[model samples]
Target: MDSPEITEAMDALRRRLVPGTRTILGIAGTPGSGKSTFATWIQQQFGPGTAVVVPMDGFHLGNAVIEGTPLRRRKGAIDTFDAGGYLSLLRRLVRRDEPVVYAPEFRRTLDEPVAASIAVPADIPLVITEGNYLLADQEPWKEVRAQLDEVWFVDTPQELRLHRLVARHVSFGMDPAAAVAWAAGPDEANALLIQATRPAADRIIPWEQELE
Candidate 1:
């Protein structure tokens, strides 16, 4: 499960660590591109007490807030997130002054973000965050990128990504037909947007190799 991309990233992160400061690494990719998996792998490689993961999905707006709006249909779109709040969390994580910082977690089974579900202790030196919009060029997202020490783009095949998205939705209780439709529609749109930000990444990791 090792690759030159990951090895290089690990070396880079280790070099960036200082006694009192924490380094933040971002993993960005299209939906179903395995950003979360990759981030977790990186954290595991770094070992316990040295690294932690904080996902951007936790910033997703609650269904209640989106239910009466057009965003309900486009649930995963950029506008459906609390970009400003996410930015605030990143800033707080950068401070590294608190005993422990609690971050929210998104539960796919409940389709909601649970408050203070993940804890980042001050002593942990590496923070790995993964999401679709980490490299986005949009307003608050542009600011979001500034908080990270380095950002890696997860490159995955479109066919595999789409297939994964369909399976993911189905696993979460969505109808097969609706899952396929969403994968082709809103998911594809968001994927394209994510793809556009690939050039901004510090590195591109081919996800297929990691999958194997």
Candidate 2:
């Protein structure tokens, strides 16, 4: 869908592209709002050689680290991520110094981050990073905003978002009832926190309407 909102975001990122420098575009939204999908679409629009997506989910604290702790229950919460490490990676991406930078990828089936799974080459002019907390007003998270050329918040309907979250959980091995519980519980809580940061985004895309 080449909607105006999508086109505008594309143009904004295109403007940031320079001969020797890289531009980082951040797509933030509540869980299940399709930020990752949107980021992928943007990458395809720009072509793989020109744009690559480096997700924040790759920084999630491993299940082993959260096991036997309260974090295990709130696995997708803000504190469940390696904020410092993500910030460090963003800094490196902004500097554009390396020939190739490897990034971690989150595996939903394993529920852990696989190290060095994504490779961001120096020639790629645009890097699109999507996640739930890119606009979060916290220590290292706020620093994440500084490294991005532009941050767009994807706004999806709450009902649609919750439905997507439940379906995602079920697809990933949770029972139907358990998926519903999770969507209404931890995921909803995270969604609320993410939504609160909407005012800070450079652009707020009505995802359901625009992307449909």
Candidate 3:
């Protein structure tokens, strides 16, 4: 979206705010659908201190936890995350009791979660969290919808999203052929699951419409 349009959307979200309460806005979509980019844009509109971005990727179970388990091969699957921990953080964010709440962050290069990397202060009114499973219907995941005031699903053409996913994998150290294979395999599988949760989102954001 253009700057003005982004500002307008941010304003609409702000209008939903209630005094002394914090709101979480979820940006959900399949891998490479631009959820993270859109969430970052929204955070920029709000600026520092007014809002923060707490990505669901941050809650990914470390390599240690998944190693030698069935989940190791399915790293990006819903089962690979620490769902309970993520839920607890959301609960705390809603209560707004603590002066500062720390959130973990996922490092793409290291392929591991860094503990307490992002801090959400008490006064920040909006928390923008982006991920693939926010609208999922499965246990633990089903409860994710309840923690957010609003959820926006980013939609992009399947071909383009797949291309982006492949490129992303390559950029992160995978060989071109391996990147393409992984994107078409595991990434596509997760995308199918995430796509099934689309109807549950509060809004659908077309990638072209939002970024053009």
Candidate 4:
């Protein structure tokens, strides 16, 4: 989207805030739909010190934990995340009383979560968190929506999304054939789940339009 459009959205979000309280803006989308890219654009627009981007990828369960369970093959499925832990962090961010709150970050190369990697200071008024399940209706996930001031669903063409997902799997070490298979299989399943939560969002962001 153009700078004016972005600024207007940000302005509208800010208008919902009461002085002295922090607000979280959630960007929810299917895998490869550019949620992270949009969140980064928001952070850049707000500039440093005023905002921070805390991603949901950090809450992914360790490989060891996943390998021991039925969820072993479904690494990106809803059950593969630490939903309670993520919820706790959201609570902390809303409280914002701590001098600084530390959050984990996911290392794509290692496919692991590194603790205390993202530091959210007391002074930052806005926290942009993006993920696939923020608007899910399943138990704890359903509660996640209440923690955020607003959630925006990112919409991208299914074919393009799947292509990017396959490329991402390849970049992360999967063989080309295996990557395409996994993207079409597991990733596509998760994408369907994510899409069901679209109506739960406060706004819909057109991914292709934004790129233009």
Which numbered prediction scores highest in lDDT against the true structure? 1
Clashes of each: 0, 0, 2, 1
Tens-place lDDT per residue, model 4, 75-177, is 8899999999999999999988899999999999999999999999988889999999999998899788889989998888988887788878888899999
Off by over 4 Å in 3: 3-8, 209-212
Task: Give the range of the ten consecutive residues with the poorest summed lDDT in model 4.
Answer: 203-212
43-78: candidate 3 lDDT, tens digit per residue? 777656788999999999999999999898789999
> Model 1: per-residue lDDT, tens digit, 1-212?
66798788778778898877788999999998988888887877765699999999999999989998999999999999999999999999998778899999999989999999999998998899999999888799999999998999998888888888898899899999999999999999999898999999999998863331
Estimate the lDDT of model 2.
Answer: 0.89
**Which residue ranges in model 1 land beyond 4 Å of their true spot?**
209-212
Better of 1 and 4 by TM-score: 1
